[model samples]
Target: MNIWESHRFGKRIHLTYHALRRMEERRISLDMVQDLIEKGTLIHKDEKYCWIFKSYSHRDDNLVCAAVIRGSAVVIKTLMTHWQEQPE
Candidate 1:
């Protein structure tokens, strides 16, 4: 199954310990994760590509999700957030 299928709320998603830690560290909410999976633009796709999207929060931080679909599960490898620099 692809990452989309594996990310179904009813389906199973396996977040690696590192991913979980990163999410927590970045204050990423489950809603943000879901938003990325559902609405984020796919920048690239190999085994998987980093999903880039704005966070659901008001801060609108840029979120990058790295995940791979394994069997019936979506294994999230890591998550990162960055502030977009405003152009003058």
Candidate 2:
């Protein structure tokens, strides 16, 4: 299945295929994503997507980010490390 559900902080989060692949490639685990969803800061958000960023003690990357489309259920669009904030 391209979409799967994960629970964090009693909220249902859905990961898209692209998000899963990026997670694997970036070596970001499901736990990391869920932790981020629970604890990360909301950096930027528009009508289409919301970006969450957090620093991990185990990782060297300054920050890990998840791009999510929020609704009744949050759909994680992708994940990234060493994220540099871009201007809108």
**Ten consecutive residues with minimal summed lDDT in candidate 1?**
1-10
Per-residue CA lDDT of model 1 for 1-88, tens digit only, reads 1233434435666667887788788887666666676666554455544444554546556545545443445567777777342334
Q: Supply candidate 2's per-residue lDDT for 80.
A: 89
lDDT for 12 in candidate 2 is: 67
In order, the Cα lDDT scores of the candidates are 0.58, 0.80
Task: Please report how far candidate 2 places residue 53 from its true position, in Å.
Answer: 0.6
Per-model TM-score, in order, reads: 0.60, 0.79
Error in Å for residue 2 of model 1: 17
Q: Look at candidate 1 and give me any clashing residue pairs.
A: none
